[model samples]
Target: MAQPTYALIRFQEVGAAKVQTGLLVGDRVLALGEDINTLIRHWDTTEGQLDALAASVDGLTGLAVSDVEVLAPVEPVQVLQAGANYRKHVIDLAAAHRGPGEDEAEVRAKTAAMMDARAGEGTPYFFIGLPTAIASATDDLVLPAYSNSHDWELELAAVIGKEAFRVSPEEALEHVFGYTMVNDITTREYVFRKDMPEIGTDWYRAKNAPGFLPTGPLLLPAKFFGNPQDVQVTLKLNGKAMQDESTHDMIFGVAKLVSEASQIIPLRPGDLVLTGSPAGNGAHWGRLLKDGDVMEGTITGLGTQLIHCKDEEPTESGQQ
Candidate 1:
């Protein structure tokens, strides 16, 4: 197998402001050699051109990776997230919230049966996230002071390369450009609506806080990242392992997610489809995020990300 091609956005200091969007290759970083937005606007055609430039050193003097700050590789136009897509995770939650006097084994059996039925007949559930909530891999996460149930959910994100509309699962993989990692942080208390019981889940406020979604230390091209279905997602909090599972546990895999998302809305290049997180969330461990906590997430072949957690400072208005 050939070496994987990885791309990143490096920041350079000039005067008082920092210049963003420098391309990174190995230890060296260089200018886009073309308009950054234009390159992504025509990603399918321009990626090859960018790759060619990265391969040559002629006339270009690049900077070292250690000297430059790194940022998120893509600024997505839209972010679509899958929910309740991991079998083990669903089963765990069901068992945790079992009815009074209910047997644990019985609950597991029933949950497994329901999951099987959904896999065979039901469609995958998806929700929208804001691009403004996205942060860089090494950025600090701000835990809202109002909610004490802040949680971590490490997920594998698929980067879209081509426009897709009502595409079939059989042909959906072709629309994928690459894979990256995202830590989908959430405030568990805001997930439900207490005032209106029938209003259903409120994912918007629960998952879209500023710096909630930290993405991409590197973007590994799809052709080089190998099988997305088999990648391992491992997360450690403060040097102790918390989430350790593989993408194989996903009830709905990448192709099914892409196909389902396209059926709802046309997916454009630079858009992201984040497959749901596996079991081992903070709720299960009974250990929510606290100030000064650190989270490290790693996906096989894709790089690792370190995020420092802190409380959101109180404003003069006293609102969180």
Candidate 2:
């Protein structure tokens, strides 16, 4: 039998600006709170009421899931993303981009060994993402005409419940309230600056474009999806499977990412710590995003996200 799945959402009537918090149960979404942001701030006290109602959805009062328009689940104060957190993903990139005479087998072996060492004592690499980059799961992505090398990185993000500062990995999971999905879009051309190599990655230009991070239609409570480390992470382009991997491939797990990130800065309610994307990104397949291309991303237990892409239209200034 399938486990009962429930989520929290923010939705509104189609084409209306009004939005409200909703409890997404079986086939319907119950009107649950005045504001989901404020509700999640006290998740420890709120989960009991939500879990009880989710245990049984019979005779629940609300609109059907299809009747209302789902919005980005939460208005996060901060969005944090980890880079190169997948073991195989790092090895694959290394092997694929090896220097002229380097053997593929040798490159893979070196990368694998480096990853093992990092797991033992290395710190995770995290960068701040703008909340402005977020979009609804079903929203259209405006493909910037500046570069045609747009790519997708489908990842699982942990939502912060309790405030955390200098927490250990062992105690990190307790602070996670739930999970959601984020598709971290990138522009390959701006990933590494050619003009100033010392500065390293230009994340703001490579990412942070409006609608670059298409987020959740659901926020699955952590208790409901125990062991997020073993879940499947898959994404398909158009109708073909482009990225199919599991969370087991991660070099650093969610808890470590959260803990390490907290050490850098305090984590608060509604803040998101994105566990990095696994292998099989667009770079692996040699096919980048384009106009009219559709991306479908899924994480086990969490719902699928469908995003559409279109080229950005030129304005009178002739800029995109």
Candidate 3:
């Protein structure tokens, strides 16, 4: 079988003759070119056409990915992310609870018990992240100064293809434009703050730091990555494979995710529902990020994203 292909939007310079990536795809970005700013201003209705344009831009002039800065694909009218979806990560964590030096027999018994608890799992767990928190490919992520439990989650994000509401799961893919790799990095302490256990009121602050959500590499059309369940997703921290799993473990896949969200809340074009991250998150092991740590992650067919954490500094343009 041939590998899946996607339309990658990127930045481009005005006088440059070679094709280039744009600063933003669904949203306006000045560095990407005037076309992006115009698109961002009208993203509400132009998203479908934009995906088509991006996918169809073959044999073009004045744009090469090398020439421009790459940004997140969608400015995102809204964002939804899932929690505890990977089966292996869930299983591994449960095994660890048996305590050190426990007999192998105890490990197997505890694993079975954990699986039973997941039976009849309800609606997919989801929380919103700020659109302003989104960053582009190659952008630097700022570690929160106030918190120390910062972490990373690698997952697949689905982009809405067209306007949709109350659609059946079987017909849901029709509303999908494509897919992208997303890093749903979080501050664990902030996310599960002792003060607020409820997700709705507290999650935004926990997950919405300036560069909490780093996405892109470009949009992989849904037709290319058929059966979202079968795709393989893996992540490595500083050259070690920490997260390796498949979307097959998702308790709720993309089709259902779209259908459920739309039944009550209207899902518009360019809205993003980041399918939940699989287990192996640093937090589960107390392996929080330290300064200068480099992490790389990827989803099959969606491409890869690399993130590095370092000490903060003032920008030349006066950004702190």
Q: Tell me each candidate's TM-score.
A: 0.93, 0.96, 0.78
What local lDDT score does residue 52 receive in model 2, on the 0 to 100 scale?
A: 79
Off by over 4 Å in 3: 1-6, 12-60, 96-121, 196-201, 313-320
Model 1 lDDT tens row, 132-204? 9899899999898889999999999998888889999999989987888999999998999998879989998
Best by TM-score: 2
Q: What ranges in model 2 sit over 4 Å off?
A: 1-4
Please say which candidate is ahead in lDDT: 1 or 3: 1
Q: TM-score of predicted model 3?
A: 0.78
Tens-digit per-residue lDDT, 32-55, candidate 2:
865876788877688778777776
Better of 1 and 2 by TM-score: 2
Candidate with best lDDT:
2
Backbone clashes (count) for model 1? 0
lDDT of 3 by residue, 81-141 (tens): 7676666666666666667788756776776566556535556666677788888656777
Better by lDDT, candidate 3 or 2: 2
Q: Single out the weakest 10-residue window by summed lDDT for candidate 1.
A: 10-19
